[model samples]
Target: MLWWVLGGAALLVVAVVVTGVVLFVVAAGKSDRVWGVDDVAVGECVTVSGEDEPVVRKVSCDSTDFHFAVALKADPGVCAAKNYSRLWFGEGDSSDSFGKWARDGLCLAHVYQQGRCYHLPSSKETNALADVREIDCSSPPATGAGENYEVESKVSGMPECSEEQAEYFTEKPTPTGYCLRLLE
Candidate 1:
């Protein structure tokens, strides 16, 4: 009788340990799961790369590599607003089968943090947010090398910037905008 009780207790302990391990493994897998453009929702963060053919990957909001947030997931040309970058799928590639995964591409908005300085296009010929790169505020670029702007505030919708000389960078769907003042 004593042996049977001891054996039963051992089995219960083993079962509990196995169950815990399985749960942990499942949770970890879910957390590490990579998401495609269609798999992501609005408000989630993502990193965008490539020039001709852009490669976008969904990432954690806190990730350092995160460049934009999914403002909206809609058809092509739906993100026709200033400062909102559109990533259209099924363009260039003529594969008919690829059309299935072509719908609901991403409309990404630049993730700008207040107080941070970034190098933006100064000329009217180029997109304002093109070639955006973070730069040290203490030491700005020389006069002909791109414009340096410091993000003053982030606001929703099209509210007028408090700073008189602040430039606006607005996104559609989400309608989040950033007020950037030229760093002189």
Candidate 2:
């Protein structure tokens, strides 16, 4: 009924360097900056991960200009961005996984560059920096055309039935493995 829208490694003895990035970039500035999950620090914000080459458009963390702080990060051998989706959808597969609901609530609109688009964070931007650019989540976007949607708070992973505590608490998955929803 409300709004609309929405790691790393250290090679010791002999390091191996690989170069071939697949990225899907989005920026609030005239030019977007490249960054990855690893580049993101704990408590910092970042674009949600998905199949689309990881997008790492940096935003100022000091300000309320972004969503989803860098709750977790992974390296090449550990897992792929798709794993981010797995971790997200499967309610996270392990003890050390990141909590999907662990995020700032002042701005709860899950605006995926105006809509939830990307699913798995890509490998390309996995090595990029993500602590610089500033995109204000509170301010009206520059385009001012995209829509925003409602976000349910108590809704846990794929709830089968609605509860009195959370009548609108619903959970669904996108093909790529994320979600876009609104009872608004």
Candidate 3:
């Protein structure tokens, strides 16, 4: 009876250990999920001006720790005034479309500082209390405006960007310019 009890206890311990190992492996796989952009969908964008959800994409580059996110959002005040411009979301291989918008709108306010991105208020003097980057996509041509976008690390998934700001994601556009963080 004593030997049987010991064996049962040992088996319990082994089961617990295996469970822990599996959990750790799963978490490790998701660690990279925090580092990419999502595709864009109409639901994510505001209908009035065709503004998509605000996005916050992290810039990955030459071993330099750039802890910042990009945002794109719309100001209803801007749209109410017949501003045909729209906000767009950019991910890996989807950055250029925002630049070629036929609406001739400015989606993102290029920031050089180190911090979170956010939306500009109706006043144009203050940003909304949200930390994100806003892009415009109101016109149909604006949808395909981006041509310089590209996807880099398949292992790392799409470029690591904050999804809290975005409402859509797309693999169609490739990222370009300085946004595509290339490892040297």
Index of the highest-lDDT prediction: 1
lDDT (Cα) of model 1? 0.64
Best-to-worst ranking by TM-score: 1, 2, 3
Candidate 1, residues 80-101, lDDT tens digits: the string is: 6544665555545432212223
Best by TM-score: 1
Order of candidates by lDDT, top first?
1, 3, 2
| Number of clashes found in candidate 2 | 17
Candidate 1 weakest lDDT stretch, 10 residues: 92-101
- What TM-score does structure 2 among the candidates reach? 0.27
**Model 2 bad stretches (over 4 Å):** 1-34, 48-52, 62-66, 75-149, 152-181
Cα lDDT tens digits, model 2, 1-184, are 1222101233321233322111212223334343433343444444533332334444664444334444344332232323322112222233222322222211111223322222211223321122112333344233322223322232334433324222221112211112333221
Count of backbone collisions in candidate 3: 42
> Which is the winner by lDDT between candidate 2 and candidate 3?
3
| RMSD of each predicted structure | 6.4, 20.9, 17.1
**What C-alpha lDDT values do all the predictions have?**
0.64, 0.29, 0.30
Clashing pairs in 1: none
